[model samples]
Target: MSIKSEPHAGNLCNLQDRVAVVTGSSRGIGFEIARVLASQGCNIVLNGVSNESAIEAAAETLRQDYGVDVLCCFGDVSDASVTADMAKAVFKKFKRLDVLVNNAGILDDGLLGMMTQDQINRTLDINVKGPINTMQAFSRLLARSPSGSIINISSIIGREGNRGQVVYGASKAAVIGATYSAAKELAAQNIRVNSIAPGYIKTDMISAVPEDTHQERLDSIAMKRIGQAEDVARTALFLASDLSLYVTGQVIGVDGGMLI
Candidate 1:
């Protein structure tokens, strides 16, 4: 891990030939983030729990479009053994990992009293424990890079109270806590840990909202528009590359002023 400072201009080199793992990257925000990194000359390891064919296609698309190596790691990130296997595969293929995007998460919206035990457990496992498992598995590999970046995808609801999202929001808030502690623990190794709290991003979830509810959401945003996945992806690009070497332990809002 390199601690030597470099000007932002020098970040122009971008992550040429670097390797990144983006979980749940078969579609939506995760895929966009992977594509953004690939566009920057970074090789990608696309991870997904199900949808094996979609994951493979996404990896192939990256390889064809960006002309960078892409591998598929299929498993639930909450399983430590799965992440361990993922680390082994990465070592065998790329032999190094420079960036880790913990983008695999799920939402189970229900009031605290109405939520089923299964829903709560699954959300916590995927949204909270998933990042923990992957970070632990890949920390050693990441440390070997010039500098490593860990980008955890949280949500604006995590930073604020949202009705019907109590459990899910708590899970995301836990990720921010993890980022703070991880940044401190990994700083000495030149590994930066941070969280991206996106607000009302354009994704499948947003697409499913009722038309009236959707309009209400748009009205609440200061920007008066929904955020695009690219908006978050570009921010991820900054964090994944040397551009954010000096930035860590932070929660960047790609929320279109929704939080402010």
Candidate 2:
């Protein structure tokens, strides 16, 4: 005898009419997260850098598929002026921001000794400083919401170090630190801050991993499989919505028990 599941009447998180900004959402995990948020009744602000056409197309897809209000703001999150402009654009159109997903990041892996200054700086700027800039620019708008949420996209490598990923790990580790501190500081204003530590996800980033190394990483997982973009997207949705109202300063892993 099989049990039947019932369909819910309303949206998952009461996020109807809310506004969310998802950085680097032109494609891949960030785009999936934005789509998930939009499906749950949240208006979305899709952000990307150096790809106006792609970003606009992503926004259009979300608008057409989910029928939710969609806006495109193209800029590098690491730039203060750009982030400020993004914030202004959001406020101008939506008047308030409910969710901020710091998903824009870069990964440049190499032996510490072989890594160049340019590689180090670029990685840190995009991965570490990018979130800092966005949070600073959008925190004011987030504070205005009754259930403001900030979701930082970190990685399991940040928690458990990986070879040749020292610089990348450091950047993500800093994100975790920022999430913890921001949660404490923003709690006074009814805002929640959390980080998602994804592990061995099957995205473009993972595709670039050497074949043998990828297999080794897969074997390390208890589930013995790579994760999907939707895995992280679902976690982001939880943090962005009121489902995680009391959850803050926590590093939730969507890593198929890899950390265990």
Candidate 3:
């Protein structure tokens, strides 16, 4: 038996006509994904909460740099009605949504014993329910497109469990669970759903950890280095494009062998 090697180069504009909505994309990992998609000619609907000015600035940059249409929707994905509104705005502006990147998530770290109901609800509402609600609102629109994808950004904590992140882990775990079930349900419509479980990606999210504590977290990674936002963005681009057309329902780890 002969092994096959993946092709090294291809045209990068395969997503020229696709339209995408990337939640919490004003900065960090989400922003990087938006940039990656836009670079490939995908129209973008940039999402964020309390970052209207930043969102507009990012959107303008995408339009100027990539010459693609970019619309900014400011809202909290955790709110059901707002999630629906975000979808509506996209449809109204772009008339199609080929990609939905559920990247809006909040992390509240605390031992289970000290975690409050408010903390648990806040984490779950955004990390888990936000994606679900967003998908529900736009599934029909996605189905209308010939090729569609839903990318749920989960975490390694969801799979292996992490101390001091009981509630946060629960929310991410739910994202992984939904990824499998939703992909199965939406496959017949030719719409794919997948989740990306990133290990120690260096984003603003990591700022929550103190400097010394962050160093310890980095030491635990087998790669001996943390990943950048572009690392996850490149993965999102692969899943969003036709390159991974046959892949679905998979929880891909962009985690430098951390799961091992």
lDDT of each: 0.93, 0.92, 0.90
Clashing pairs in 1: none
Best of the two (2, 3) by TM-score: 2
Q: TM-score for all predictions?
A: 0.95, 0.95, 0.94
Q: What is the C-alpha RMSD, rounded to one decimal, of candidate 3?
A: 2.6
- lDDT per residue for candidate 2 within 52-153, as digits (tens), equals 999889889989998999989888898999999999999999999999999999878999799999999999999999999999999999999999999999
Error of 2 at 115 (Å): 0.7
Q: Model 3, 18-133: lDDT tens per residue?
A: 89999999999999999999998999999999869999999999999999999898898889899889888888888899999999999889986898888888898989889999
Model 3 TM-score on a 0 to 1 scale: 0.94
Deviation of model 3 at 129, angstroms: 1.0
Model 3 ranges with Cα > 4 A deviation: 1-9
Task: For candidate 3, list the clashing residue pairs, or say none.
Answer: none
> For model 3, what is the alpha-carbon lDDT of residue 234?
92
Q: Roughly what TM-score does model 2 have, to 2 decimal places?
A: 0.95
lDDT of 1 at 118: 96
Q: Give the TM-score of candidate 1.
A: 0.95
Which residue runs of candidate 1 sit more than 4 Å off their true CA positions? Answer: 1-13
